[model samples]
Target: MRAGTLIATDSGNTLAAVRRCEGSLERMRGLLWRPALVPGQGLLIAPCNSVHTIGMRYAIDVVFLDRDGRVLKVCPALKPLRMAMARGARQVIELAAGEASRLGLLPKRVVRWQETLTA
Candidate 1:
């Protein structure tokens, strides 16, 4: 699926908007020069297990997910110049600070894109 907002159907946790980073170059430059992440805005990097905030300008919340979109872990308020990892994560989501808690994005929670009905 093309990149979009991923909402938790069961818990109503909304992950704002999302930008995809799949290729090596895209993944490597994930959120590097962004000034800030608005609430509900995030970066989704696929096939990633670890991430570093070496050049990030602000802190963010991180959600690690498996291939099936089940959350593997959640790291809140991860500051810049830091790093984190999830052993079995196939995707990593980076969100604005506190967005994770507000959305109740917890481990095992399944996240998916909302389907919009056609006219």
Candidate 2:
């Protein structure tokens, strides 16, 4: 999901929005490893191919997406010191942990990515 917004749904309604990252080494290094206060419609474009060793004050749900923005893997409540790997993922989105379960996101579930007017 190249530099786009990730809309998580709960009960068929949008619950949270997370910026999609390409998971490049440069992008990963550029991103703040701390908890971020992103507003509604916020987005963080990443340059890498995956995210690793995320250290934040709170746990977050991670969604691994393929080149087509398809949901490849979902790791709910990913706590600090925990690691999630996306073998076939081209991008990874970090959302508030447990958001995945609340959104009923599971393997094989397809996530749709809509391009915003602004980056």
Candidate 3:
């Protein structure tokens, strides 16, 4: 999948170096086998309202977003073997633990993505 930077436009915060997970295969793999997610890194899964961390090796923070890129909810430090769902979320961003707070990705915040030109 192509990568880019996700920013919280409201606070001018750079949320993460994100990879878009749009297709079934990409969404399914959603950080499952990664030993750890580095700071400033995350996965943006579109058209997704629910996520499971059943096999994840580490905790993560989840931000549920609407179609307009507004945050509907923020689930922080979600431990392994758990699931999170937002009723009206159209997409979700999964970040390393505490990355949400650090970036001020709270509910109602707006998120924007800028594509990175890969060499």
Candidate 4:
């Protein structure tokens, strides 16, 4: 599989694509998963209730959101092999380590994903 962007409301929040594993709740149990995306990369709507782990890659910022897409937690530069947990997270967005700070994604911030038309 190829890597893809994790886009959000803000502009130029794209991150590098590494790898993504979706629809593997059973297989991802207890294992650290990181939503890998390069800086300034954009990602579409992603499901919550999933744990993302960043392995072998550099640090990244993590944003946990509720069903309404409200920012719950923003973990900046989360080290590799480190895990960020969000119990009520309806969706978790992974951004470049410092991109969160650059984009000013703070708590209670509202985020919306811009849909892309695919041919």
Q: Which one is best on TM-score?
A: 3
Identify the superior model by TM-score, candidate 1 or candidate 4: 1
lDDT by residue for model 1 (28-77), tens? 88888867888877888888999999987789999999988899999999
lDDT-best of 2 and 3: 3
lDDT of 4 at 119: 64
Model 3, residue 32: C-alpha shift (Å) = 0.9
Poorly placed runs, candidate 4 (over 4 Å): 1-36, 42-45, 49-54
Worst 10 residues of 1 by lDDT: 110-119
- Name the candidate, 2 or 4, with the larger lDDT value: 4
The candidate scoring highest on lDDT is: 3
Task: Give the Cα-based TM-score of candidate 2 against the true structure.
Answer: 0.64
TM-scores for the candidates: 0.86, 0.64, 0.93, 0.64
Please give, for residues 9-116, the per-residue lDDT of candidate 3 as tens digits: 877766689988868988888889876887889889988999999998899999999999999999999999999999989889998999999988888889987778
Q: What is candidate 4's lDDT per residue for 6-69, written digit by digit as tens?
A: 4444555633332333554522432234345556753322465444554535666777788876
The local lDDT score (0 to 100) that residue 108 gets in candidate 2 is 68
Candidate 3: where is the Cα deviation over 4 Å? 11-13
* Model 4 alpha-carbon miss at residue 58, Å: 1.2
Decoy 3 TM-score against native: 0.93
For candidate 2, write residues 1-119 as lDDT tens digits: 34444454323444346454445554555335644434333233332345554555555567777766567887776676667778878666666555667666677666655554663
Q: Name the regions of candidate 2 deviating beyond 4 angstroms.
A: 1-15, 21-26, 29-49
